[model samples]
Target: MRIAVIGGGISGLVAAYRLRQRLGADADIVVLEQGGRVGGVLHTRELAGEPVDLGAEAFVGRRPEVIELMSELGLDDQLVRPAGKRPLIWAQGSAHPLPGRTLMGIPSDAESLRGLVDDATFDQVATEPQRPLHWEPGADIDVQTLVGDRFGSQVVERSVDPLLGGVYAGISASIGICAALPTLATALDNGASSLTEAVRTAMPAPSSAPVFGGLRDGYGALIAALTAASGARFVTTMAATRVARAPGGWVVDPIGAVDAVVIATPAPVTARLLHHVAPVAARAAAGIELSSSALVAMALPRETPLPDNSGILIATGEPLRAKAFTLSSRKWPHLAEREVALVRASFGRLGDDKPLFWTDEDLIAAAVADLSTVTGIPIAPIEVVVQRWPGGLPQYAPGHVERIAALESAIADLDGIAVAGAYLHGVGVPACVASGTAAARRVATACIENTQR
Candidate 1:
């Protein structure tokens, strides 16, 4: 039973691993990775003689997928949580405490955003419940449009944009509420009279468990474990050029005939592969857009005197080049033990990807200058690493939910092949893991039925 898993990202790797567990020793699972290595955007590297994640640093621990997978892989010992510190919002040329108990930066009450916004905006948010709201049930629109109309531009720009940018690598103006903030959307659908009420109703109940988790060594550990456990033949630097219907099953180009295929690539690449087999699905995927981003990880002196906060998020309209700063040493307890302080400066977004083209030296300089401006500290880096992620994140634009639904429906009847990636339900590591597991189940089930026949 030969199977092919294309892409080699978290989604693809998880699919291959799941397939191995389901199909056992007899199945031949091949992972085709176009890059020199696996882990697509989940790459980790050494910095100052210690492993640090160059791509995604953490996963939402509240989500069961990552934690459960860690336990299954005997990697629970490597799990580490954050220090429960909150990030600050850099706006209006000052740093303000990020509004608490808010739903993705949308304030549940005016008090949360009191000092963050100006007097006028604060007053508007305070009286927001008094203002009548008209929301169409089952409607979808950008977060900025919905929040801006009710809470004013400051709430969307200063409060919401930064948080959304951190998640989507895009601004609130491009992110849809239905997918980005499902709980709030359901609240609005259930007849919430105001945006404030929706946010309040949608806020997650307080829990003692940490919100995020990460591997002690880095994501590279997780990737290495998944690759080994999958027991799949790794085909590095090989891109699956085509996937077409073959007698009894399918033929994956260069990989030959296989009982099944998991196309877990980026949206554009997935669209291209599905074009011949699932044209409608291809069009839907092709319509989905991607956002680029860059990161500058700097290791400064251990006594750099950085703020006590977790990180600083930049608001829209801010003059700063960096979108956010993750104080690695402050945020993660495990990293605090390092001899030097670690900070990661994020750059680029959906509309602005100029930083991706900037040289590593330029990116490092911007990160240094911005860190100095935000922290009021003299900038000096003992070591630096710059990583560029072009087309890294898929924008969950307005109508995204509907588009994905249609795409999935169009491919429902395609036998022995399935699609999965960040472009699906979410862009987070947990979401990708879920998508891959589901894809493997679908493919494995189909392969079994064929064998029975």
Candidate 2:
């Protein structure tokens, strides 16, 4: 059997690796990467002789899939934790620690939230009458509406919006409350009813495990290892312009043919690839939106006094050039040898373009100004690099789940074809791997069914 995996991003790589694991040496596996190198979003850059991650910085801990994969690749020991895992919120002209008792900005601890807001606001939040309503436990709902109803518009706009911008690079209004955060939605459905109560109930159990971890060398190591194991022919600078079905399976024109295919590229690219194979699916994919973002990574002199926490996320309305800056030196000590500071200034999101978007020089100036306000440290970056990702972050708009389900249904009817990436599932490294793994399993099952037939 022949299998061709499209897009050598993490998803494509995982799918190919799983095929090798499940189908053994009998099946021929090929990975077609449009880029010159693998590790789509897992890029690592060097600054002042120290490795800096420009793409995904860390994966969530306790996520068994990422941890298991790390162990499999013998990259577990390289895992390092941030100095203080808690991220500070930059709001109200200052950087404030994320209030305790909150689960992703939802009040898990009402008392903790009191300190975050004024006394009057706190009273209103705490005494806010729970409107008479009934939502089933674990029932899906819109997150933005849920937050505004349970908490207040203030909480959502001031905290939630900026936080989402920091991590998802999107507007909270766009992200499906249930799909992006299922547990909280379930809690809201339960008698916990209100946002504060639901947050307290849904708060993650305490664990000794670290909250975040990154490779000693970098995430690039995992990408390289996965690429090597896939044993697929890599083609860089060759963007897959189209995809179509061929006899017995599928044929990737100008590339080759295979019994199966897995697309692991971004939403736009994936949509373009599916246009010829399945117009409906392509259209559905094209409609799924994404946000633009830029990460300005700078290496500051060790003498700089960075923020206390791992990083700080500015509030939605806060006047700043960038959204937040994660102190890499504080987060992962090993990454910086000297007193140098490794800072990542994230800028831009949907409906907000204050990143001073233009040349890297302009972007850098804006990021520096934002950093000055948040960190109170005025220092020039010795080495700075700007990575602009246009429409990189997928927006899980309202009714996203339904659209995705419809798209999946359409794709299921097609033989020897599969779509897997962050766009369909959670937009993180773990989710991508899970999606790829599932696709690989599906392919293996198809191969078995073909043999029986």
Candidate 3:
């Protein structure tokens, strides 16, 4: 049986790899990637004689899938914990350390947010527990609306917006609380009187292990390892334009017939391919919005004294153009062994227009200026690497989870066909891995059933 996996990003690669493991030598598998290379947003580049991630830098260590994948790839020993984790929030023309006990900027204790919010806002938050929770169970609401209603707009702007922006690259006012922060959402659904208490109760206990994990080499290593192990034929620079139902199973346009198929590309591309076969699912996929952003990596002199924190997140209304910054050398001690300091600055988000419109040089200049302003240091980098991701992050609007479920149901009727990627579930690396693996399992099950019949 021939199986086709479209889109060669980590999700697609994982789907293809898992499929090979399940079917073994009996199946004919082909991976179709439109780009010349794999890895998608997991690109890594060499700078100052060290491998630095230009795309996603790390994955949440608490998620077992990524760690398990690393171990399977024999990258267990290469897993390195971050040297620093705490990041500051740049606001009110000053840098304030983020509170320790908070989930996605939602404080578990009002006193923990003393310096971060104004006195009026603090008073409002202090009284939130006594205000009597009023929320519809299982109903989706924008993050800002919920958090703002309970704690006022100040907390949402100074605290929640920055943290959510770092992840979704979208505005908190539009992002669904349930989709973005499920723990908090569950607590709200359960009628938790205080969001702070709810988040605190839901948060896991602090562990000795680092919150995030990255490969000593780079995430690119994972892509390479998966490709080598998948044992699937790769067809790079070949985009699958369509997926139509065939007599026995399915046909991937320009890629010939396949008994099974996994559409692992972005939602828009997935929608286009599945349009004729599953119009309802295609419509749901197309409705999901995407956000764009750019990252500027700079190599500064080793002697430069960067901030002690891991990095600084720019709160909304700050005088800086960049939304976030990562002190790569400081966060990962291994990078500091080199003769240069590595730093990455991120620009743009859902409602922002500059990053999409700015030239590479403009982005670099803007990043440098913002970094200097925040750190109070005169910045001059020896080298700069700019990476732009257009529509990189999918916006999880209200009812996103439900919409995905409906899409899944719509496509479930088709035999040996499944969709997977960051768009289907959570957007993190681990979530994508799970989504891809699950899709592979579904296709494998269908293939087995077809043969039996």
- What are the TM-scores, per candidate, against the unseen true structure? 0.99, 0.93, 0.97
The model with the greater TM-score, 2 or 3, is 3
- lDDT per model vs. reference: 0.94, 0.77, 0.88
Clash totals, every prediction:
0, 5, 0
TM-score of candidate 1 to 2 decimals: 0.99
lDDT of 3 by residue, 1-453 (tens): 899999899888999999989998878989999988888888988876677898888899888999999899888887888886688999899999887678888877789898988999999988887877777789898888888888988888888899888888887886897788887778777877677667876777888777898888998889899999898899998899889999999989898889999999999999999899999999999989888899999999999989977889988888789999999888887777889999999998987756868888899899989999999999999988888888888899999989898899999888899998887789899999999999999999999989898
Which residue runs of candidate 2 sit more than 4 Å off their true CA positions? 133-141, 336-339, 353-356, 451-453
Question: Which ranking of candidates, highest lDDT first?
Answer: 1, 3, 2
TM-score of 2: 0.93
C-alpha positional error of residue 95 in candidate 2 after TM-score superposition, expressed in Å: 2.1
Clashing pairs in 2: 101-108, 101-109, 143-177, 302-339, 302-340
lDDT of 1 by residue, 1-453 (tens): 999999999999999999999999889999999999999999999899999998899999999999899899999999999998999999999999999889889988888898889899999999989989999999999999999999899999899999999998999988999988899889999999998889889999989888999999999999999999999999999899999999988999998999899999999999999999999999999988999999999999999999999999999999999999999999999999999999999999998999998888899999999999999999899999888899999999888999999999998998889998999999999999999999999999999899998
Top candidate, metric TM-score: 1
Window of ten residues with lowest summed lDDT in model 1: 107-116
Model 1 misplaced stretches (Cα beyond 4 Å): none
Question: Candidate 2's C-alpha lDDT?
Answer: 0.77
